[model samples]
Target: MKNIRNFCIIAHIDHGKSTLADRLLDYTGSVTEREKQNQLLDSMDLERERGITIKSHAIQMDYIYKGEEYVLNLIDTPGHVDFSYEVSRSIAACEGALLIVDAAQSIQAQTISNLYLALENDLEIIPVLNKVDLPSANPEEVTDDIVELLGCNPEDVIHASGKTGFGVDKILEAVIERIPAPKGDPDGPLQALIFDSVYNTFRGIETYFRVFNGEIKKGQKIKFVATDKEYFADEVGTLKLTQVAKKSVKTGDVGYLITGIKTAKEVKVGDTITDFERPTTNIVEGFEDVKPMVFAGIYPVDTEDYEELRNSMEKLQLNDASLVFFPESSAALGFGFRCGFLGMLHMEIIQERLEREFDMTVITTVPNVSYNAYTNKNPDTPFIVNNPSDLPDPSTVNRVEEPYIKATIITKADFVGNVMSLCIEKRGMILNQTYLTPERVELTFDMPLAEIVFDFYDRLKTVSKGYASFDYHPIGMKTSKLVRLDILLNAQTVDALSALIHADNAQNIGKKMCEKLKELIPRQQFDIPIQAAIGAKIISRETIKALRKDVTAKCYGGDISRKRKLLEKQKKGKKRMRQVGNVEIPQQAFMAVLKLND
Candidate 1:
C-alpha cells in the first residue's frame, strides 16, 4: 500500500487520453493478449460512436518496477468541455493527474482550461507530450510551452506516443516518482470520496471511491455523508483494468464496493463514504450540483415504447450523472420526458442512443437555454422556464435574461475578417484579439449562448475553410429581447416544434423555419397550414399541400394481401410524423427549423 499511487488522466478532446490509458493497461500487463481492446476506457457505444469520453472510467494495475510490485490506480476522464464537471469529480478522487498535451497541437484552449482545474485542486501533475510519433510532432517545443505555462522544468516532461507504446515505461516510472503515494491513516476510521457510481443489476448500486483514510472491509456498516444513509457493504472489489477481481481493498485503493442500495437515487455522485461505527467530524465539500445547460423534449417514435425509453434512460443515468430528465406529455407524441443535458453534443448522444441501443426512435424538440423571467407587476416573483411554451406572457415578462458565453476563436489570420463578420452577424461582440503566431490569431467575443447552440460551429468551419477552432466559457446572464415562437398546425401547439428567438429576428427567422419545416415534413393526406407566430398574430406561413393520392386505386378485395402490404408501407411513412389536426410533421422537420439559415 505504501507504493500505491492513485492518479487521473486529463486532456482536451482528441488529445489521446483514452489511447494513453489503453497503452498503460497494456504495458502493465493488466490487459492480456486475448483481452486487448481498442480505446479501453471508452466502454459505451455512444462514446465510441462520437469519439469522445462521456464518463469517467477507472482501472487498477500492478506494475513491477525493480522487482517491486506497486499498485497503480489510473482514472480516465472525459476530455470534452461539456463533461468538465465529471472531470472535476474524477480529479477530486485522485491525488495526482497526468496532463496529456498533443505534440502537434501544442496547448489548446480546453487543455489550458482543464489544466487550471487540476492546479486549482492542488493535485500533483506530471506533464506528458503525447502523439510523439506524428510526422509534424514537435515534442521539444510543446515541452517548452508546457514548462512556461505550468511552471515545470522542461526536462521533466515525459515524451511518448501512446499509440506506438513508446516511452510508456518512462511514464509509469514518472507516475511512481512524481505522484505522491496515497497518505491516510490506515488504522483510523474509514473515509472515502464517492467520485462515481453505477447501478448494478445484482448488487444494486455500486459506488466507486478512493479510501483516503482507514481500512474498509465487507460487512461493515457505512454512512454516506451526502445522503446520510447507512448500509452494509456486500462486497469490495478492484478493477483489473478489464474484469472485476474480488479482493480485499485497503486505503488508497481505487475500487467499486457494492451495497444493498439498488438505484442511482440512493448513491449520489460526489458523496463521501465513511464508517458509521465512528463518524468523523470533518466534512469534505461535495461537488457542486451541475445544472443542465441545454434542455430538449425527447419522446419515443412509437407511443408504446414509452416504458422502454424510461428504462433505457434510467440505465444510462446509472453511469452518467450529467443527464437529467423529467416527465413530459405531448398532445401529438404522447408520454415522454423532458431531458436536460450539458450541451448540444450531450443531447445528440442521448437521442442517438434511444434509437440505436434501445431500438426506439425519438422525436426531439429544439434545444433551448434555461431562462429567468420577471413580470413588471410582480417584481418580487421570478419564473423559471425551460420550454419556450412555458414562458410567461410577452407583456408579462418585463425583463428576460439568458445565459451568455465568452467565446474564443483560434484560426488563421487570413480568415480573421470572415470570422469577425460572422460573429457580428450572430450578435456577438468582439472583446479582445491576439496573435498566437504570425499566421495564427485568437479572437475573443461576448456572444449569446443561444446563437451557437446548433450548427454555428459547422458554419464557422465553412466560413473559415475548416481552419478555425472555437472554445467558450459561460460569462453569466445578460438581458435580451427574446420571445417564444410557437408553430401551430391548424390551431394546436406542435409541442415537438417550439423555438425561442430574438424578437428582432422573429419574422425572418420564422419564415426560414417554415421553409425548412416544409422540406423535412412529408405532405399529409389533407392540406396542412404550417404557420409560425408570436402569440395570436402569425408572421410566417407555408402550405404543405395535401397528397393527391398516396395510395393505389386498385385492390379493395382482389389481391388483399398485396394491398395490405402497400397500406402498411404507407402507414410506416405516416409513422415518421407527429400528427396534429390535419397535419403530420416529421421529426427532422423540427430539427431543420432549428438550423434554418434561409
Candidate 2:
C-alpha cells in the first residue's frame, strides 16, 4: 500500500483537468495510440458533444518510478457547480487532489469553491498552473495568486500545459512523492466505501467502491451495511480502460463489485461493504446526502408509459445519485414525479439523458425552488411548497418564505457594474465586495434562489461576455411577499403552468408568460383566452383570436337582414364551442415560463 496513490483532479469548468488527465494517462501508458481520445474519461456521447465531464470517472494506472512500480488510481471529477455533488463524492474516495487552475483566467469562482471542498476533506493539495501554452497565459502572476489562495510556496506550484503536455512528467513525480498512500490494514475486518454505482442491463448493477480496510476477493460473500443485504461477489475487478477482472482487491485500492443484482433499490451510494460473516462494526460515513436546489415535475409524454418512466428513472438514479424524485400527479399533465436537481443545468442534463440513455420521452414543467409555507392554523410548522399548487389558500396562509442563496460571482473589474446591476435586477442585495486583484473582483450577494432559477446565469454570462464565473449555496429561507401565479386557459387553470413568484415581479412576469403563450399556442376554432391570474383576479391577459371562417363569404348577394341572422347564429355556435373546447397546449408552452425574463 505504500506504493499506491489514490487522488482526484479538481478544477473549474474548462480548466484543462481532463486534458491534463489525458496527458497523465499517456505517460502511464494506460491507453494505446489508437485508443487515445479527447476527454477520454467522459464516455457518454452527450458529454463529448458538450465538451464537459458530467460524471466522475475512475481508472487505475501503473507507473514505474526509479525502478519501482507504483499503482495510481485517478478519479476525474466534473467542475460544474451543478455537479458539485459529483466532486464531493470523488473527494471522499481520494487522499489527495490536484488543484488545476487556468493560467490565463487565474482563480475563478469554482476554483475557489473546489479548493475549499478539498481542504474540508483534509486532502493534500497539489497546485498545478495549467494552460501555459496559451499566448495570453500568465504563469508568474497566476502562481502568485495560487500561492496566496493555497498559501503554498511559489516553487511548489508546477507550471504545465495540458495542450502541449508540458511538465507532464513532473506532475506524475509529484503525485507519487508529495501525496501519501492510502492508510488501512489489509488483514483487519473488511470495510469499503461505495462512492458510486451504475446500472448494466447485461450484468446488473456494477458498484464502484474504495476499500479502506482488509481486502475483498472473488466469490466473496459481502453485505451492504446500510441496506443489510447479502450478495456473493460474482466479479471483482480494478477499473482500467475496460474493467480487468482480478482475484482480489486489497486495502487502499479502488475497484468494482458485481453481484448481478438487477433491482436498483438494493444498492445505495455511501453504503459500506463488509464480509457478511465477519461484518465491520461501523458503516463507512462517506459523504452526506445531496441537497437539491431546484424542483420541477417530469411526466411522460404518453400517460400510459408512466410505469416505464418510473423504472427508467430508478436506473438512471443509480448512476446519478444527486437526482431526487417522488411520485406526483398534475391535473393537466397527469401522473409525474417532482424531481429535485442541483440547478437548471443539472435538470436539463437529466432530461436529455432520460431521452437518450433510457429512450424515455418526458415533458418537464417549469423549474422552481422549494419554498416554506406557513398557514394561520399551523404557524409554527412550515409545509414544503415544492409545487405552486402546494401553497395553501391565500387567505389562510400567514406568510410564504422562499429559499435564499449566497451567490459568489468572480469576474473582471470592468464588468462589475454589469454584474451588480444584473444581480439587483434579480432582487439581490449586495452583501460585500472585494478586489482580488486590480483587474479582477469578487462580489457576494444575498439573492433569492428562485431569481437565479431561470436565465440569471445566462444573463450573467452575457452581460460579462463569458468572463464571469458564478457559484452559490443555499442560505436557508427568508420571509418574503410571494404569490402563486396561475395560467388559466379559457377560465380553467392548467396546474402544470402555474408558478409561485415574488409579488414584486409577479405582474411583469405574468404578462410576459401570457404573451409568450399567445405566440406558441395554436389558434383553435374558438377564441382562446390566455389569462395569467392571482387568485380570482386576472393579472395579465392575452387573447388568441380564432381562425375566422368567413361564413358570409359564400352569400355575397345576401340581404343585410339575412347576413345579421347568419352572424348571430355563428356567434351562438362559437360561444358553445368555447365552452367545450379543451386547449391543446404545446410542450413548448409548458416550459415558456423559464424564458420569461429573456
Candidate 3:
C-alpha cells in the first residue's frame, strides 16, 4: 500500500486527457512501441472517431524512481458533461487527480465543473497545463487562472505538452511525491467499492473495485451490500490495458473480480461488495444510483424488429447501466422502447450504437425532459410523465412542473451579449455573472432543461462562433405555465408528435410545427389537413394539397357536357376518398418538429 498511488485525469472535452494517458502508458512501458496507438485508453471506435473519451478506464503501471519502485494506478475519465457521473465515480476511487487544461483554450465550463467534483470528493488536485507546444499556447495565463480558481500556490501548477511528450516524467514524479497512498485496515472485515463493471460472455460479470478493508481471493464467497446476492469469486486480477490474473487482491488495491453471476444487473456500479459469510456490519458510504434526465422513444423502422430491438437494447444495457428502457407502443410508429438517457449526447450515442453496433435502423422521437403533472382532483399526488401522450387532460391539470438546470456558460467578453440573449430567449433567468479574465466572462442562469435539451447548444455555438462552452446540472423542478401541444393529421391526433411546451410560445410553436409537418407529409388523393392544437382548440393549421391530375386534359375537342360530367364524377370520387383515405405519414414527418429550434 505504501508504494501504491491511485490517481485519475480530469479535463474538459478535447483537452488532451486521453493523450496524456497514452504518454504515461508509453513512458512506463505498459504498452510497447508496436502496440502503442493514439488515444490508447479510448477503446470504442466512436470515441476515437469523435476524439473524445466516453468511458472511464483504469490501468496499473510500475515505475522506478530514485531507486525506489512505485505502483501507480491511473484512471482516465471522460471529460464531457454527459459522463460527469463516470468522472465522479473515478474520483471516488482515486486519492488524487491530474486536472488537465488546454493551454490555448485555458479554462472551460466543464473544467470548472470537474474541479468542483474533484474537490467534493476531497481528492488532491494537480493542475497541469497541457498542449504547451501549440503556437497559441498561453501557459502563463492558464497557470494564473488555475491558481486563482483553486487558491493554490502559483509554483504548484505543472506545465506539460501531451502532443510532444514533454514534462511527462515530471507528472509521474509529482504523483508519487504529492499523492498519498491508499489507507485501509487489511485485517478488517472485507469491504470493497464497485466503481465499474463489464459483462463478459465467458466469465460473466467482471466488476472493477477498490478494496477498502481486508482482502479478496479466488474461490471466496462475496456479496453485494445493495442486492445481498452471494457469488463465488472465479478470478482476481488487475488491469494492465487487459486483465492480469492474480491470486489475491489486498486492501487498498484496485482490481477486477470475476464472479459467476451471469448478468450485469447483479453487480451495480457504486455498490459495496463484501464477504458473504463474515460480512462487514457497515457498508461503504457515497453510493448513489445514476438517474437519467432525458427521455425519448426509439422505434424500429420495421415493426417486425421489435423483439430484435429489445434484445439489442438489453445487450447494450449490460455494458451501460445508466441506460433505462421499457416497452412502449405508438399509434403511428408501432412498438418501441421509451428509453432514458443522461443527456442529449448520451441519447445520440445510444442511437448511433444501436444502428451501427446492432445493425438495426430505428427512428427516435423528439426527446423530452420529465415533467411533474398534478390533476385538479389529485393535487397531492403529482404524477411524473415522460411522454406527452401520457399526460392527463389540460382541464384536469392544476399545475405542471418541469425540470430546471443551473446552467453555466463561459465565453469571450465580446460574445457575452449574444450568449445572454440566447439564454433569455430560452426562458432562462439570469442568476449571476462573473469575469474570469479581462477577455473572458462566465454567466450563470436558471434555465429549463427542456428549453436547452434540444437545440440550445447548437445555437449557443453558432451565436458565440464556436468559442463558448456550457455545462449544466439538475436543480429540481419549477412550476410554469406548461401545456401539451398535439399534432392532428386529417383530424386524427398523432400521439408521437405531441409535445409539452410553454403556454406563451404555444401559438408560435404550433404554427411552426404545422408548417414543418406540411412540408414533410406527402400529398395524397385528397388534401391532408395538418393542425396543431392545445386541448380541443386548434391554434394553427396547414394543408398539403392533393396532386393535380388534369381531369379535363384527355377531353380534347370533346363536348362541354362530357367535360362537365367528368368533373362532377371526379369531385364525387374526391369526396369519397377523403372519407376513407388515411394520410401516410413518413418517419421524417414525425421527427420534423425537432428541427424547429434549429
Candidate 4:
C-alpha cells in the first residue's frame, strides 16, 4: 500500500493527454518497443481515427525511484465534455490527478470543469504544462494562467512537452513525491469500488475496481452490493498491457476480477464488491448515477432485428455505463429503444460503435432534451416527455418545462461579440462574463439544452475560429412556451421526425425541416408533400416533384391533340400513384435535421 501511487491524467480535448500517457508508459518501462504507438491507451479504432479518447483506460506500471520499487496505477481519461463521466469514474478510483494544460490553448472550459471534479473529490492536483515543443507554445503565459487558476507557485508548475518527452522525468518524480499512496486497511472486510466494467465473449464480464479494504482473491465468492448478486471470482488480476492474473489483489490496489456473470444487469458500474461470507458493514458510495441530457430513439433498419439490436445495446452499455435506454415504439419507425446520451458527440459515437462493433444497422431519430409536461387534470404531477410523440395532447397540456444548462465558454477576447450573438440567437440568457486576461474571456450563459443540441458547438468553433472551448451542465428545468412540431409525408404522420420545439422558433425550424427533407428524400413516381405541422395548422410544406415519364415518346411526330391526351393520361396516373405511393425516406434525412444551420 505504501508503494502504490494511483492517479489519472485529465485535460481538455487535444491537450496532449494521450501523447503524455504514451511517454509515461515508455518512461516507466510498462510497454515493450513493439507496442509503442500514438494513443497507446485508446484501444478503439474510432478513437484513433477521430483523435479523441472515448474511454478511460487503466494500466499498471512498475517504477524504481530512490532505489525502491513503486507501483503506479495510471488511468488516462477522455478530454471531451461528452465523456466527463469517464473522468469522474477515474477520479473516484484515484487519489490524485495530473491537470495537463496546453501551452498554446491555456486552460479551456473542460479543463476547468474536470479540475473542479477532482477538487470535489479532494484529489491532489499536479499542474503540468504540455506542448512546450511547439513553436506556438507560450510556456510563460500558460504557467502564469495555471498559477492564477490553481494558486500554486511558479516553480511547482512543471514545464513538459508530451511531443519530445521533455520534463517527463520530472513529472514522474512529482507523482511519487507529491501524490500520496492509496489509503485502506488490508485486514478489514473486502470493500472495493467498481469504477468500470467491460464485457468479454469468452470470459463473461470483467470488472475493473480499486480495493479500499481487505483483499479480493481468486475463487473467493464476491457479492455485488447494489445488485445483491453473488458470484465466484473466477479470475483476479492487475490491469497491465494485458490482464495479468494473480492469486489475490490486496488493499490500495487496482485490479480486474472476472466473476463469469454473463448477465449485463447483474454487473453494474459503481457498485460495491464485497466478500460474500464476510461482507463489509458499510457499502462504498459517492459514485454518481449518469445524468443523460439528450434523448433520441434508435430503431433497427430491419424491424425483425430488434432483439439483436437490444443485445448489441446491452453489450455496449457494459463499457459505457452513461448510456440510458428503455424499450419504445413509434408509429413511423416500428419498435426501438429511446436512449439518453450525454451530448450529440456521445450519441453519434454510440451509433457508430453499434454499427461497427456489433454489425447492427440502426436509424437514429431527431435528438431532443427531456421535458416536463404538466396537464390540466394532473397539474401537480408532471409527465417526463422524452419523445415529441409522448407529449400529451395540446389541449390537455397545461405547460411544458424544458431543461436548461449553464454553459461556460472560454474564447479569445476578439470573438466576444460573435459568441454573445450566437448564444442570444438560440434563446440563451447571459449569466455573467469575466476577463481572465486582456485577450481571453470567459462567458457564462443560461441556455436551453435543446438549443445547443444541434449545431451550436460547430457554430461556436467556426465563429471563434476553433479557439473557443465550451462546457455545460444542467441548471434545472424552466417553464417555456413549447409545442410539438410534427412532420407529415402526404397525410400520414412521421413520429420519428417529430420534435418538441420552443413556440417562438417552431415555425422557422419547421420550415427548414420541410426544405431539408425535400432535398434528401428522393423524387419518386409521384409527388410527396413534406409538411410540418403544429396540430391541425400546417406551418411549412415542400413538394418533391414527381419524376415525369415521357409517355408520348412513341409518337415521333404526334399531333397536338395526341400530345395533350398523353399528358392528361400521365397526370391522372400520377395522381393515383400519389394517393397510394409509400415514400422511401433515406437515412440521411433523419440526420439532416441536426445540421439545419449548415
Candidate 5:
C-alpha cells in the first residue's frame, strides 16, 4: 500500500486546479501525443463551458520515482462552494489532498476552507504553489501565508508552475512522502466507498469506489453495506487519466467497476460497497451526508417532454449525487419535479446541463431554503417549501430564520474598504481579518448564505475587477427580518420565481429583480405587467410590451409546411415559457433575476 498514493487537487474556483491535473496527466504519460485532449478532466460539456469543476473526476497514473514504480491516484475536486458536498465526497475517496494555491493570488477563502476540511478528515496535505510562471507570482509569500493560516510547516510546499511543468517531479515525490499510503487488511473483507457513479446507455450503471480493505477482482460478488444489494463485478477499470474511458483498475486503486446495476437508485454516492462473502462487521465511512440547502421546482418547456426530463435527471444523478428531485404538481404548470441543491450555482448548473446535454428546455423555480413555520394547527410539523406558492401563511410563520454562511473574502489591499462597505450593505458581520500577504488581506464575515448565492460573487469580482476571490461554508440558520416578495404578472403571482428577501432591502432588491426579469423575458403574445410586492404594498413594476407579430405572411399551400413549422417552432418556444394566469415568462427570467447585476 505504501507504493500507492491517493490524493486530490484542492483549490478555489479558477485557480488552475484542472490545468494542473492536465499537466500531471501529461507528465505521467497518461495522455499519448496522438490522443491529447485539452482539459481532459473536464469531461462534461457544462464543465468545459463554465471553466469550473462541477463534478469530481478520478484518474490513475503510473509514475517512476527513484527507480520505483508508484501508482498515483488523482482525484479532481470541485472548487466552488456550491458543490462543497461533492468536494467532500471526492475527498472521502482519497488519502491526501494536494493544496493548490495560486502563487500570484495567494491564499483565498476557499483555500482555507478546503484546507480545514482536509485537516478535519486527517488527510495529509502536500502544498503546491501553482502559476509560478506569472509575473505577479509570490510563491514565498503564499507559502508563509499557508504556514500562518494552517499553522503547518511551510516545508511541505512545492513551488511549481503547472503550466511550465516546473517542479512537477518534486511535487510527485512530495505526494508519496507527505501522503500516507492506504492501510487496511487486504486479506480481510472488501470494504469500499461509493464516491460517485455514471450510467451508460449500453453498459447500464458503473460505480466508482475506493477500497478501504481487501482485494476486489472481476467476477467477484459484492454487496452494498447500506443497501444490501449484491452484484457481480463484471469488469474492474481505472480512469483513462487523460480520457473519459475506463482503464485497468486493481486493488488499492481509485477507479470504477461495472456491476450490471441498471437504475441509479440501486447504488448511491456515499454508500458503502463491500465483499458479500467476507461480511466485515466494521465498515468504512465515506463522507458526511450532504443535505440540499436550496430547493426549487423544474418543469419542461414543453409538458410533453416531462418524461424525457425525468430520464435526463436520473442520468445526471448517476454522476451528481448532490442534486435531488421529487415529483411536483402545479396548477400553472403541469407535472414537474421539486429539486434541491447545495446553492444557486448548483441549481443553475443542473438546469443548464439538462438543457445542453439532453436537448430539452425547462422552466426553473426560484431557489428557496426550507423553513419551519410555527402554527397552531401544525406547530410541531416542519413544512418544506420550494415555490413561493408552497409557502405557509405569513401569520403562521412566527419567526423566520434562514441558513447563513461564515464567508471570507480575500482581495488586494486597495479594495479592502470598498469590499467591507459592500459586505456591510449586505448585512454581513465582520468576523476577523488577517494579512495573507503585504498587499493582500483575508477578511472573514458572517453573512447569510443567500447573499453570496446571488450576485455577491459577481459584484465582488466587478468591484475588484475580477481580482477579488471569495469562499463560504454554511454556518447554520440565523434569525432575520425576512419577507416573501411575490412577483406578480398582471396582478397574478408568477409562482415560478418568487424571492424571500430581507425587509430592509426588499424594495430595492425587488425592483432590481423585476427589472432584470423584464429584460430576460422577451415580449409575449400579450403585454405582461411585472410587479413585485410584499403582502398588499407594491414595490416595483415593469411592463413587457405585447408582441406585434412573430410570423410572416407566405403562400397558404406551398409555404404551409414551412409556415406551419415556423408556427410550431413558435408554439414550442411558448411551451418553454411559464404561464402565470395571464402572463408568460421565460426560463432565463428566473436565472437572470437572481443574478441581476452579473
Candidate 6:
C-alpha cells in the first residue's frame, strides 16, 4: 500500500489532460507502441470529435521507480463545468490531483473552479504547467501565477509539455514522491466506495469502486449500503485500459465489481459496498444523490419510437446517474420524457448520445431552469415548477423565484469591458474583479442561470474574440419579477413554446420571438397569426400572409361585376379556412425562438 498512488488529472477544457494521460500510459508501459492511441481514455467517439472529456475514466498502471514496482491508479476526469459532479466523484476516489494549466493560455475559469473542488476534497494538489512546447508558451509567468493563486512554493510547480512528452519522467517522480498512498484497514470489514457504474448487455451492472477497507473477491456476497440489496460478485477485476479479471481487490485498490443484477436501478453512484453477512454499521459519508438543475422535454420524432427512447434513457442512466427523467406528454410533440440535466452541455451530450448510440431521432423542447412559485393564498407553501406551462395563474401567484448562479469568467484584460457589458445585458451583478496578471483578468458575477442558458456563452465568446472562458455553479433561488411568456399560433397556445422570462425584458424578447416565428413558419392556405402574450395581454404579434391566388385571371373580357363577385367568394373561402384550419408549426421554428438572442 505504501507504494500505491491514487490520483487524478484536473484541468480546464483543452488543457491536454487526456494527452498527458496518454503520455503517462506510455511512460509506464501500460500500452505498447502498437496499441497506443490518442485520447485513449476518451472511449466515446463524441468525446474525441469534440476534443473534450465527457466522462471520468479510471485505469491501473504498474510503474517501476528505482528498481521498486509501484501501483498507480490514474483517474482521468472531465474538465467541462457541466460535468463538475463527475469531477467531484473522481476527486473523491483519489488522494491527490494534478492541476494542469496551459502555459500559453495561463489559468482559466474551470482551472480555478477545479482547484477549489480539489481543495474542498482535501487532496494534495500538484501544479503542473502544460503546453510549454507552443511558441507562445510562457511557463515562468504561469508558474508565478499559480504560486500566487495557490500560495505554493515556486520550486514546487512543474513545467511540462504533454504534446512533446517533455518532463514526463519528472511528473511521474512527483506523483510517487508528493502524492500519498491510500490509507485503510485490510483486516477490517469490507467497505468500498462506488464512484461510477455502467450497464453491460451481457454481464448486467458493472460498478467501479475504490476499496477503502478489507478486500473483495469473486463469489463474495456484497451489499449496496444505499439500496440494501445483496448480490454475489460474479466477477471482480481491475481496469488496464480494459477490464482484466482478478482473484481479489484489496484495500487501497480500485477496481470493478460485476454483480448479476439485471437492472440499473440496483446500482447507484456514491453508494457504499460492504460484506453482506458481516456488514459494517457505519456507511461511507458524503454520498449525496445527484440533483439536476436544468429541465427539458425530449420526444422521439416518431411516436412508435417512444418505447425505444425510454429504454435508451434507462440504459443511459445506468452510466449517468446524474440524469433524471420521467414520462411526459405534449399535445404537439406526443409522448416524451421530461429530462433534467446538470447544465446545457450535459443536456446536449445526452441528446446527442441518445441519437448517436441508440439510433433514435428526438426533438428536444427549449431548456428551462426550475422556478419556485408561491400562491397569494398559500404563501408559505411554494410550489416548484419545472415547466413554464405548469405555472399557476398570474393573478393567484404572489411571487416567483428563479435560479441564479455564481459565474467566474477569465479573459484577456483588453476584453474586460466587453465582458462586463455582456453580463450587464444578461442581468448579471458584478461581484468582484481582480487582475490575475498584466494581460489577464478574472471577474465574478451573480447572474440568473436562465439568462445564461440562452446564447449567453456565445455572445461572450463573440465579444471577447474567443479569449474568454466561463464556469458557473448554482448559488440559490432569488426572488425576481418573472412571468410566463406564451406563444399563440393562430390564437392557439402552444404549450411547448411557453417560457419563463423576466418582466422587464418580456416585451423585447416577445417581439423577437414573434419576428423569428414569422420568418420560420411557412405560408399556408390561410394567414397564420403569430402572437406572444403575457397573461391575458398580447405583447407582440406578426402575421404570415396566406398564399395569394388570382381569382379573376380567367375573366379577361368579363365585366367588373363578375370579377368583384369572384374576389368576394375567394375572400369568404379564405376567412372560413382561417377559422377552421390549424397552423402546423415546423420543429425548426421552436428551435429558432429558443435561440433568438440578438
Best by TM-score: 2
How do the residues 228-322 of candidate 4 rate in per-residue lDDT, one tens digit apiece?
98889999999999999999999999999998888888888888999999999988875789999999999999999999999999989999999
Clashing residue pairs, backbone N/CA/C < 3 A, model 2: none
Clashes of each: 0, 0, 0, 0, 1, 0
Which stretches of model 1 miss by more than 4 angstroms? 243-247, 304-308, 465-467, 549-581
Candidate 3 positional error at 292, Å: 2.1
Instruction: Spell out the clash pairs found in candidate 6.
Output: none
Which residues of candidate 6, in runs, are more than 4 Å off?
A: none
> Which TM-score value belongs to model 1?
0.90
- Candidate 3 segments whose C-alpha is farther than 4 A from its true place: 548-550
| Deviating ranges (above 4 Å) for candidate 2 | none
- Please report, in order, the local distance difference test score of every candidate based on alpha carbons: 0.82, 0.94, 0.90, 0.94, 0.79, 0.91
Query: What is the RMSD of candidate 2?
Result: 0.8
Candidate 3 per-residue lDDT over residues 62-145, each given as its tens digit: 999899998899999999888888898899899999999999999999999999998988899998999999999998898999
Q: Per-residue lDDT for 1-598 in model 6, tens only? A: 8888999999998899999999999989999888889999999999999999999999999999999999999999998888888888999899999999999888899998999988988899999999998999988898898999899998999889888899899999999999998999999999999999988889888899999999998999989998988899989999898899998999999999998778777888888999998897777765467778789999998999999999899889988878999998988789999999988889989989998988988888988989999999999887999989999999999999998999999999999999999999899999999887789988999999999876887788899999999998889999999999999998899888899999999999999999998998889998899999999999999999999798888999957999999989999999999999988777787667667865
Q: Which pairs, if any, clash in model 3?
A: none
Candidate 1 lDDT by residue in tens digits, 1-598? 7799989999878889999999999989888898888888788887887788888898889899988999998889988777888888888887899999989877776777778888888899999999999999988777877987889888789999989999899999999988888887888778888888876677677778888777677788889887888998888888775447464568888888888786557777777788898887666565787878788888888899888889888877867788999998878788989888988877877787667866788889888888878898877666888888788778777888888999988888899999999999899999999987667688999999888887777789899997677778888888898888888775677866777889998898888877787777776665667799898889999887766554756765677788778878876655444354356676777677666763
Alpha-carbon lDDT of model 4: 0.94
Candidate 6 has an lDDT of 0.91
RMSD (Cα, Å) for all candidates, in order, is 6.1, 0.8, 1.8, 1.2, 7.3, 1.5
TM-scores of the candidates are 0.90, 0.99, 0.96, 0.98, 0.88, 0.97
Given candidate 3, what's the lDDT at residue 448? 95
Tens digits of per-residue lDDT for model 2, 256-321: 999999999999999999999889997777789999999999999999999999999999999999
Q: Residue 365 CA error for candidate 4 (Å)?
A: 0.6
Ranking by TM-score: 2, 4, 6, 3, 1, 5
